[model samples]
Target chain A: MSEHGTTLNIEKFGSASEAKALSAEADDWTLIIRPQTGWFDLHLADLWRYRDLVTMFVRRDFVSFYKQTVLGPLWFVLQPLLTTLTFTIIFGNLAKISTDGLPKILFYMSGITAWNYFGECLTKTSDTFNANASIFGKVYFPRLSVPISIVISNLIKFAIQFGLFLVFYFYFLFRGSNIQPNSMLLMLPVLLLLMAGLGLGSGIIVSSLTTRYRDLRFLVQFGTQLLMYSTPVIFPLSSIPEQYRWIMIANPMTPLIETFRYAFLGTGTVSWGMLGYSAVATLVIMTVGILLFNRVEKTFMDTV
Target chain B: MSETVIQVRDLSKRYRLGVIGGRRLVDDINSSMARLLGRQDPLAKVDLLPGADKQKAARSDEMWALQNVSFDVEKGAVIGIIGRNGAGKSTLLKILSRVTAPTTGEVRVKGRIASLLEVGTGFHPELTGRENVFLNGAIYGMTKAEIRDRFDEIVEFSGFEKYIDTPVKRYSSGMWVRLAFAVAAHLDPEILIVDEVLAVGDAAFQERCLGKMEKVAGDGRTVLLVSHNMSTIQQICKECIMLKNGSIHKVGAPGSVVSEYLSETRVATNVDLTQWQDRTGNGFAKLSRMAFLNADGEEAGIFPIGTTICFDLETTYNRELIDPLFEVIIHDPAGEPLMHLRSEHDGLRIGKVNGRTSVRARVDNVGLYPGRYFVSARIAAGGRNVDFPRLCGSFQVTPSPGRHGDLRLNPKWGKYHLDSTWTRGDQ
Candidate 1:
């Protein structure tokens, strides 16, 4: 009796709250479902209610990220550092791309750190429908949580790479390098938000499309690579000829990379107009992405 | 009276048939453009209409899995949905659980519903038992605090406390199922929808989970269950809805509905039943074949009166079994059971049996009156029946000469025949 009292006690178990959710007059209401009348039906409040689910997804992704690898989390730091070295050798030494007078290695590392987050967000979110078809087929969850967790999980990797950049920055600074971080460093968060929004927006759109047309998956892979060259990953935005500046600036990510560099290295272009333009473009793409994602998530299991 | 918790109105789901579900790029672009232009999807007339990819699509390459189905359930109601494969029973559960959307109509649910379609729907193999409990709890929409409070009870119920911290990948399938069922049953669902997920566990575990579900229903919470096990529905569900060919065939008390389902499958008895779906057992042993026999102990369909009535039950064991009991039951043409026989009850010992053994249970001089009767055979071990073929096979009984000289027997007389002597006596 005591054992049943301890475990099976309804009130103590706190499931009564979920029950209370039913007794409320609101829960008993009718929900009319039909072909969506409009483009957007984002269930924001439901997503908020399932924040714990999103947290678990993020934890699962991050924890399982390096489960069996011998080097484990050390690979987090090693990956970006090695990439920066390769970029320093190839783009900086061979091609001799201008970094706007910033140290070539530091410049490449910062760019890689910022661009890596965006690339991870894009690839991971693009695979959401295909990779999670097993779970989505059996369970009811805010499908948005899957992509949201991808963005957040990739942020942890971004943070590790960013920390490595900081370590190098301090090393060069204490060793009497001429570079100094500018006040634009405060714009770092806005720059990251733009990248995340763009990646998430484009990722969901491609993922939703790939549910029916799988070719988008391969396109996303090569597309993200080609997209990096168009952005100022190795070269500063100022290095682009003035005539070609419009083409570079048109790629919304170009302004993000330039702003991020200007904040850390204090040498690239950062403007209220360009940042505002990129922000508006990102918001619009995100709105479209969400609509497509919402439309496809309900029935993607059949096609995916 | 409890209020109606679920009201499904004209619910329908349509699904395309075969491997063409992944639409070609050309067709998808055309459909998307049509939607953008505010036109009915041209493909939807022939394929899934976007959200209507669940079941029963009826067009060129499509078929409607469910068509205009409607039902209502009151709070505290334990309702069962029974159907053959592709009868849309699962599609209905998916709609009610909100796992899939109905193509047309609306279902208003007045409670926080949780559906256990599969016991380990989202269980991660890499996660420890404790971690999976919380993960699975959250998947059921249980809050963290609720899971934390119920954590110990769940572990106790599963009887895996010592291995709670061990990764579930290392656990046996049975052990994994127990933990998953334990978590699913304890999640405090106001309206629980279960779909044959509880069928995987051992009989005792299945019984305990069924008891917990009954307790939940007894608390005036609604439950919708789908199972092929007729006895399970009869045990917990008061009402049963039988679906046939994607529509509601009947809805009434569990007895009539279950009997109807049983009779429908009676025609399939002519074929081998090794692939039959509706059976419950630990699966250590299986009944391969069942046949009625005559005095010679050879397989026969007709038995004469005053002749030995017996049956041959072939047993196959994947692993060795101990003291397994093989039994047969005879039912008259009226569907009333005439006799129940168990090898163990008859004091027949089948100790330490392995693969491919046949056993017989017979009564010298058939006591049953001549008529047609049915037989069902099963093997049981560890207090649980394993291979129970609902209708094993049927045979005919006819009259022959006895000591009393050609005494005919039929259903008009009582089922049993007793030898008697008439002598000169004073009244």
Candidate 2:
């Protein structure tokens, strides 16, 4: 029997815990029945034990998107590929946007891959309250599972795009194109991390806000498009004039996108210090996002 | 001794009833601006305090959906939470299930909780029924293998095998509810919370659901049920809790709690609409009040099934009323209409009753089940008529020991035959 049960043993305790404890005490699950006062004092251990639920949510998100469509999961790859081609033709040729000496197709494809992950994460997370209000009002699961699952689900789209990016990289190399490798390639994971963190953080924050103001819901779609322009998705970071460079650097996503391009093509500028600042900023945003989300999860149904 | 699985203390939830319009936006912005200045806003002051029911007097301000509610459930206890509309029964379940937080107080629960608050709420409309079963079960925290083990059970329970591969949107509403309920009931959880979702299905399905709930209760799992159906509550719940105006009115054995609820709500000879002042509808003829008189011509709140009664109804029309036909319907607690009487069938009509008029209906043998019933009246002129409006009356038909089989009188011609002259000629 567990210590808590033994302390209040008016009746004989079940041997379920004792039997498991005999083999390995570490392996035995602990059930805590705490009287929590507010949202700040959540039972984290219980949430941890139910991590499988988070996984299931992610699976549901991924599978349901492609279940009935004729093209199915292939749309995951095609969506980004088509967007990259459109940007290449319009921004690269017609508008003549600077790609910083890299091939137009590769530059736009890389940006689309990173940007799509963030955009999907933000849009999905922002709409969480409105989309799942019906279910959230009925069941009791760790609400964090929802945003976490969104991030994971969007990763599938990113992975498919990444595969296309790899194909383009190999094709450029086989065509005898001049692309050199640098130590900055090691920073790709960090860039991906920053993108994921920023999207999830910003998404959850806006999602919570939209539950109340509802005006935020209207802004979410338009705001995401405007936000893309502020980031160096189609243009090189170096093209920004000196006076506006500081503003671009402070955008956080600027350093992230710059580092990703520099690592892949060895053409754009890479600043380790700027990348470090962006990473720290992403972490801070995610923490605040989580806090706001926790508070909102408790009362969202009332407002929703 | 049975284990105690859930303990609740002083749980209450307050909901703000904001006005529906652009004015609400101004209040919201003003509150945020006031907070920026480190000052309290005028609109924030409208928040209802915990345990306050006075806030409901105004329709625009916040309402305390739940107030000072407290109860505990023993392990394996099947508790029915009963109340009138807006009594906070659903809010209480939401709090217990952790879907929403209480404004004040705490709940200590032991074991994994599963709430069927809305059957198949997690289901995707475009997904196949089979796919939804797995998806919903997984969302409820069951493992894929666990769902696989229960898949056949779920399919059988829903009885939707023919359409299992079809998308849920294509299924009929009843089939959707059945599939949703099937997934919820099959997932074994230590504590099960169910709302009034079972009312969506047909009679046989409802009976089957009741049987399933009984079986779940018998398995030593804790169950919290919120429902308006008193008969279902009495059948399945050993204990009951009564909520009134967002507060705990009573909690104990099912019989006592239900009876207390009935007695507390018992009206005299006349029905009062003053308490239910708030009304919802386009302006038409409205039922303001009603009454039922006993043999002594005194107001009788309750009566036996066989008792003769005089039902008096008062209604006010918003527009012209001419050649109005009135109808009264009596429904059981399950919302199944037991008896219907229309004034037109009996050649009873009022010509051009334009204003408020008290119409009296003399009824004989008002056969009813031994439960609470709602009486609604409708008035119509020609083809167009007022929606069933002014008949907000509830009455109880006390159970009689002598009436064994059914509540209604079953007439027979065995002993009371007067014309017996040719009875021997047939032989």
- Give fnat for candidate 2: 0.26
Task: Tell me each candidate's TM-score.
Answer: 0.74, 0.85
Considering chain A alone, what is the TM-score of candidate 2?
Answer: 0.85
Looking at candidate 1 chain B, the ten consecutive residues that score lowest on lDDT are B51-60
Q: Once superposed on the true structure, which residue ranges of model 2 sit more than 4 Å away at CA?
A: A1-47, A67-82, A181-183, B18-29, B32-62, B160-162, B274-281, B294-298, B381-385, B400-427
DockQ of each: 0.17, 0.23
Against the unseen true structure, what C-alpha lDDT does each candidate score? 0.78, 0.75
Ten residues in a row with the worst lDDT in model 2 chain B? B411-420
Residue B418 CA displacement from its true place in model 1, Å: 23
Question: Mind giving the per-residue lDDT tens digits that candidate 2 earns over B204-312?
Answer: 7777788889999999888888887887788899888887777776677899988887786776457665355434444467766778787677788887766767778
Could you tell me the TM-score of candidate 1? 0.74
